[model samples]
Target chain A: MTSLILYTPSGVLAKGGPLKLAAKRLKKLGFDVAIDEAALAKHLRFGGEDDVRLEAIHRVARARPGIALATRGGYGLTRLLDRLDWSLLAASVEAGTRWVGYSDLTALQMGLLAHKKAPTWWGPHACDDFGRDELDEVTPDCFAEAMTGALEAVGFRTESGFDGLDTRGLMWGGNLAMLCSLLGTPHWPKVRGGVLMLEDVGEHPYRVERMLLQLHQAGVLASQKAILLGAFSDWKKSPLDRGYTLKTVVAHLRSLVNVPVLTGFPFGHVPTKVTVPFGVKGHLVVQGRDAFLGWDEDHAHHHPGHDGHGHDHDGHAHHDH
Target chain B: MTSLILYTPSGVLAKGGPLKLAAKRLKKLGFDVAIDEAALAKHLRFGGEDDVRLEAIHRVARARPGIALATRGGYGLTRLLDRLDWSLLAASVEAGTRWVGYSDLTALQMGLLAHKKAPTWWGPHACDDFGRDELDEVTPDCFAEAMTGALEAVGFRTESGFDGLDTRGLMWGGNLAMLCSLLGTPHWPKVRGGVLMLEDVGEHPYRVERMLLQLHQAGVLASQKAILLGAFSDWKKSPLDRGYTLKTVVAHLRSLVNVPVLTGFPFGHVPTKVTVPFGVKGHLVVQGRDAFLGWDEDHAHHHPGHDGHGHDHDGHAHHDH
Candidate 1:
């Protein structure tokens, strides 16, 4: 079985039940799940004090599990970006530890890409996606297949328009707000000609537009081959917003930038998120209304040593679609 | 008589009552006020379409009023930043137009500073601050005084710490979220050894902290002489936020950066706001619990040609102190 470590490096885990349940589910899925000792440590709204959370991160990196997952994301990783030992995290990646999680984890993943050119996964968190009262069937299955190296590609349907579009670039980005927070910082990855994937929750469309405009104004969007927009969910509509909706926002963005802006990617603060490899080279193909992002099976299967399991987990990526 | 132009460069007015009321109030305060032709134009949530707003800006610059006040700030300026004619605006500044407002106006103000090194006022909006049923006593008095070149310094009381402390640097920054949005963009003003002032409304402390950390990690805070924090108001408390408050946020930020973080500035999205000059050199002095930010009187009075009113506006900056 592939060893996996679950830790809380961002928001505090409200109760231990969810974490325990997540571990139980992962164990059943063939992961030798071990929770970090200080995973449940609390400090204000964070999982732990800054130093404690920092130490837990280094501890997980040192352990070098086949998969290192975050419990949940609220807002803590940006605080530790300055003090993080990127080399140690990169070393763990070299030793086959596939760091996984999205939202707040974008800070760590983007920082790793900027500092050490290491890849991580933009996937479901241990608690948020797997430990719910009603689990997302597709989430766990996709995560399991990806971890076991049998998942090489993920596909979704975007708005029709880019039907013959095909491009290849480094896959990058995560929670839109988290990615924007790293702008102008040392941790900001300067990935030119990359396909940027973006998603957010609870941010109004205007704010989403503002951040996208920031990226466009910074020349980040122009340098990319394509812009993949995932779910922008949970935001409330204001009375002030007469006809300005997310659709209008996308239209306005399309008018502003020449880069192809594709929407409806199965990711973000939603339950059924696909496990995509951040920092890997991905080939994107659009056929009719369907978009497929595929990576080399060899590269996706990072941990060759952990492939001794006889279980085959292919074709799980299409279940969510 | 000093000529002041009122224009809507950002959000829609919703109704024209406030703009009319604001103009009447300004006229009562002894100024010849004129509303822009497209001041009340509405397109979705913005005051007008992008081109119309952009034209209104250039039109104001061409008219060369003593004061150019934004009607309100909702979310339109960032879209116009790239298309703005900086030299025209700078020329208007040189010819004596005191551009003023906060919130979304931060984008235009910072862009002016970055492109042409011109100063603008971080002051009140025409509608939001002046058009209310019950007006704030200190706001109009401060604006009138500051416009006439009589108000040199504004003081406030803060937590006791750095007594007898004096530092001088360029004073910049407004609307924390707007400022952060410009980061990594060409419009980001590279102000070193500056006294950075920041404030916002409706953003959780965690988001505020993340933006501050971005500035800190970007080396912006380390390069600043001191930081002036105004009101971070309008955020609601969450059950998960145990003891996490704006107070704790300031404490955490102070622990990370070497710059002095002074609070209690009378600004932000509040009724009683002081009119302060943005992009101008300011002298900051601390005595016991009192802090005062003083700018050169000659510089504060940008419109020397309009000073023939024979009205003494001195001593008004202390009214709110």
Candidate 2:
């Protein structure tokens, strides 16, 4: 049976309705779920104090479960980056522990990439998405396939602009605000020739423009092969915004940078979300308005002659469609 | 005659009530006040379109008035930084144009320092402070003194502990969010051993801590001589937070970083404010609970045996009490 560890590295699971329901579903789906003792420990707005959250991470690293899933995401992992035992986390990754979550988890996932070049999932958190009463068919299926090493690619419908697009590079990026927070810090991975995917929740178009400009000004956008926009939902519009929007911001960025930015990515804070791996070689191909991101267990086909430290060599390689 | 240019570079001046009143007051106080044509122009939330705002800046640079004051501050200058003519502004600064304003102006002022080490005043905007029904005594007095070269120092009370302390460095920093926006960009000034002063409005203590942590992680705070925190006001506390406040955030930062974090800075979105010169040598001395920040027009006294731009060799040196 697949073993999983339910950890809380962000805000406390006050009610944890989704937590209990998600565990029940995971058990029904034939996975052994172990709830961490500190998962519900509350210290004000956080899951626990900084030391408590840090200890949860270290404990998961030592346990090396099949999946280390966060109970929720609010704001806490950033406080632990400087003091985290990255080597132990890297060891857990080597032992086949796949860290999963998004939102605030972007900090830890990005930190892992910057320090150890280890891979994590930019997917659903335990409570927020998976813990719901009616779990979406797409989310659970994709997650299960990805976990069982049966999923290799995700196809989505996008706007038809880049017809003959073909590129393969390291897949990276998560929540935009969290990504912006990591800028200039040691945790920001110096990625080049990457397929960067981005999404956010509850951010205005102007604020989104500001964060995008920050990345553009830092030369990060220009260095990437392509930018895949997932979702920017739950933002309020001001009467002051005559015609400005996320589309306008995207158009302005496209006009400024040479990088191709594609939209209609089915990820981010949404009901039907797609699960994708971070810090791995991803092959992107655009056929008309359709885009596909695929990877293989063997890095030979997707990333030829690339000797990056992030390349997992344990041979879990297989094609999933 | 003391000439001033009232321009709008950020949000729209919907009603010219404050703008007109401010001009009338300045005229009464003996100054040639010329309002820019675009000062009242409105476009969505901005003072004007990007090109219009850019033209206003260039026009002011060419005119080189005694003072260039912004009408109000919201959020717009971040868009114009890359397209701004920094050299022209720097030349205007050399010609003794005291570019003044705070809030959003922090972007332009910090950009000026990053590009050419020119000085600006972190003072009140035209409509926001001066145009009010009654201006605060401290507000106009500090602005007048700083503008007329009579303001050499600012003194305030702080928590007791840091007494008999004496240090000096280049005075810098404004608007914590704006400063963080410039991180990892070409516009971020590489100031070592500098005295950084920061303040903001409507940001939670967690966000304040996050930005501070970003600076600390980027090796910015640790490189400074001291950190002077101005007001962080008008923010509401979340019910989730037990007892955390801005003071708690400061205490946490002081515990982590080995820099003197002093408080009671009378700046930011407050009625009683202090205007100080940016990019100038600042002499900091703490006597009991009283802290003073003094600077001379001649950098020789405070910043001895150091020459990396911003030194006025023309010798406009005068001490103000």
- The most accurate candidate by lDDT is 1
**For all the predictions, what are the DockQ values?**
0.88, 0.52
Ten residues in sequence with the least summed lDDT for candidate 2 chain B:
B306-315
Worst 10 contiguous positions by lDDT, candidate 1 chain B: B307-316
Report the C-alpha displacement of residue B192, candidate 2, in angstroms.
1.6
lDDT of 1: 0.89
Error of 1 at A294 (Å): 0.5
Native interface contacts retained, candidate 1: 0.88
- Give the B-chain TM-score of model 1: 0.95
The residue-by-residue lDDT of candidate 2 on A126-199, one tens digit each, is 88877887777777767766666556678777898888899988989999988999999999998999999999
Model 2 lDDT, residue A235, Cα: 91
TM-score of 1: 0.96
Q: Give lDDT tens digits, candidate 2, residues B1-321.
A: 779999999888779788999999888767799999899888777889889999998999999999999988887898898899999999988887888888889999999999999988898888999898978877776777667765677788888989987989899999998899899999998888989999998888888888999999999999999899999989888876767678778888998889899998887888777878899989888889978788765531122232222111122232332
Fraction of native contacts in model 2?
A: 0.64
Using DockQ, give the best candidate's number: 1
